[model samples]
Target: MTLKIDCQLRDLDFTEVGTHAQKMEEMGFDAAWTFEAGQDAFTPLTLAAAATKNIHLGTNIAVAFGRSPFAMAQQAWDIQKLSRGRMHLGLGTQVRAHIERRFSMPFDHPARRISDYVRCMKAIFDNFQNGTKPDYKGEFYQFTLNNPLFSPGAIDHPDIPVYLAGVNPRMCRAAGEVADGFHAHPIHNMSYLKEVVLPAIDEGAKTRGKSVKDLHVQTMVLIAAGETQAEIDKAVEDVRMQISFYGSTPNYRGVLEHMGYGDLGKELSQMMRSGQMAEMPKKIPDAIVEQVAVIGKLSEVGPKVRERYEGVLDRVAYYYPIPKDAEIGNWKAFTDAVKHTA
Candidate 1:
């Protein structure tokens, strides 16, 4: 079993990412993942690739709808070559609003679009490496690369792995059928993962005649560590606030409702729409917080995380939300404790 440690890019800057990637590599972590919500992940990833030599650098998820498949393949291939073959290109289809409204692009049939996008990317990489023209005609994308003048020329190809970010059943099955790995969201609980997500993956793999080992399962965990009770309370509140925001989204409401917190989802949704998001955490039920988060003492968090990985997850990515200047002693202590379990 390998233990991979990754922190969210939301809480870290470019300089911090390079420094932390080196530190995490020294700490025996297998990989470091960067995220993109509003900021571009490519710049920080390039810095991380330059700073670290061993640890794999990847995106927790780069939204596929924001960029074309050809451009994304070129960027991932360049990064893979630069990192000396230690790059994983993780992609996800975000909500329709981000695609249609924010980016001013078409958003239709996301499942099919993701499938076609992956095929197109892999075909482009293969064609570029073998010095052969790529002729692919999919429903969403069509490409014919036969011109030498526009080509980047024959280059050494690197093994670039693709992981899919999935939460629902159909997405999980799609990832299992085609993607190298499945990146699960942070709010999912162990029971839901074991009963819902893993079974779906297995079903899809069975249909495709692929072994379970061929599919990697990566999950995100929100973590905070502190000695005092008050500090721990603050950390828990921070996670609660994040969950509150996610619960309000229409796509994630079903997940919260499935966990027996449907009313809380409704309340949080109303609060978010009315511009009272900051106060919404105060109304979250304690049961829901305990079910979704790994809060409390270092000793307590280790076993809870281990429990989440018992039968389903292959890699666990911890999301650290503390400021750079803040004391990270407690955070380090928590990781040290969990290292034994891993």
Candidate 2:
């Protein structure tokens, strides 16, 4: 199994990002992905690209509705060039409320939108690489930039891989049909991944006359590693809180409900909607915590990560810093444990 060690950019500043990127590359990490929930994932990704020589730089997910596909294509192209062709463009359609209310953008037919977006991006990149004009006219986006002055000439391999973040079956299927890879949400368990997600992807691929081998399955796993049981308990609680925050959303509640935690899901939904943030974590049951994250000693964490990839996922992106720490000793331990497992 191929393991891809990665973390979010949340716990790292600019200087720390550079250092982490180099260190992660040295530690045999295949990729380094950053988050863009409230911050731009591109700036740090550029810094990571500059700092590392081989490790792939990417976003866990950059919101799609916030920017036009043209802009995304240009950014990905530029980053791929800057990184010497070591860039992965991961995109996701954030929740409807965030898109409609916060960004004032339409969020209709997300699966279809993502499919078109990927096709349009590929066409644009092909145009730049082949010195030809791309004529793309879809329901959502239409563009034809021929002989443009701002074109970045051509790239060696403009076919930079596109990864899609998906949780629902439709979105997962769309990822299989269009994207080069599929990124499962961190809250998902191994059972859901194997039973629900993988089958949907395979069905989608079959419809397109494709196969599972054509796509990569990448999952983000929250890992908290420590030597002592007290430290492990604290880390596990931190993961539980994070899972509570993610599970409180109505969309994610479905997954929790599927896991036979419908009552907890309803409670979390009520709390989140009422803005009772402080009381949210208290509702997350211990059983749900074990299902979501790998929280334990370094020895235990490695096996749990391996379990996720047993017969389903192709890569695991281990997110670090369950809490704040100046030194990445916990991350180092987790990676060392993963290597030992291999």
Candidate 3:
């Protein structure tokens, strides 16, 4: 399958979101996504939906535990209507600490909770679209109350695609069983995807009488590509730091362990405990960086990514920082190359 290139809109200025999305559409991107970092994920997509006509809009992830299913379904339904049926609502079960301490929400049984969460959202969507009674009672959530006044009514495009973001086996399985697509973490190599992620998702898919091929597998790739060696080196260093940061999390230690870096994962966790965040990147070696990120010249990146993930992934986006205005042409070249490659 030919891999489609997706774009993540990171422009912080709300006023510039529509224009940025328009530029991505003109560049021939398949989707424009936003993450729940410092701002609301759904809000920007609403802007993008209004500003652009063809490009798909989605949340790279909105915290599923942070909002009720009703609230999330409401936003998704409105966007699907406004975008004329081009909204993919991606949800994530953020780390326990963030879900509990940061969002002041409960985080018990995250895997099951997220699975039930997706079902609940779908139930709500069904009720709105087909006038089906909202009577879904899952382990973590229940949706039995939906008055006609509370409903957003029916829309022409009510079949919104839902994607789940995960790294561990259980969550990957949950995505397979429940979601329309699975979002792979950037802190991963092909080995982990083949040995861990794909098998886990397949296992879950079997429970639902489906298979891995039934779901879309999208990943965020850390690409260290640049016009010059110096720029490439800087990008590689940035990717190394990102890998270290993500590998420190216990939930993601499996990826490191599978990559023969279990001890490094432990040390990174120790550094996090000791508040040595600034020194953690130095511990990641160049070899690890090369394995985790695609390193090459600007012209070589597209083909290298295709060679690495041609059949395994349906869509991919760069995990690096959004390119500056001057750097947009280079990114456009990468996207064009990805589309035209044999």
TM-score of each: 0.91, 0.92, 0.97
- Model 2 Cα lDDT, one tens digit per residue, 233-289: 888878878888988877786688778887777788788889998888888888888
Every candidate's lDDT: 0.76, 0.78, 0.87
lDDT against true structure, model 1: 0.76
> Residue 197, candidate 2: how far off, in angstroms?
1.0
Models, CA RMSD each? 2.5, 2.3, 1.4
lDDT: which candidate is best?
3
> Using alpha carbons, what is the TM-score of model 3?
0.97
Q: Which candidate is the best by TM-score?
A: 3
Model 1: which ten-residue window has the lowest total lDDT?
321-330
Model 3 Cα lDDT, one tens digit per residue, 1-342: 778888787755889888888888877778878899989998889988999999898888999999999999999999999999999989999988898899999999999999999999999999998889879999989999888899999999878989999999999999999999999998888999998998999899999999989998988889988889999999888888898898788888888888888889889999999999999999998877888899989778888887788888888887664554735666677777877642
Better of 1 and 2 by lDDT: 2
**What clash pairs does model 2 have?**
none
Against the hidden true structure, what lDDT does model 2 obtain? 0.78
Q: What is the Å distance of residue 76 in model 3 from its true position?
A: 0.9
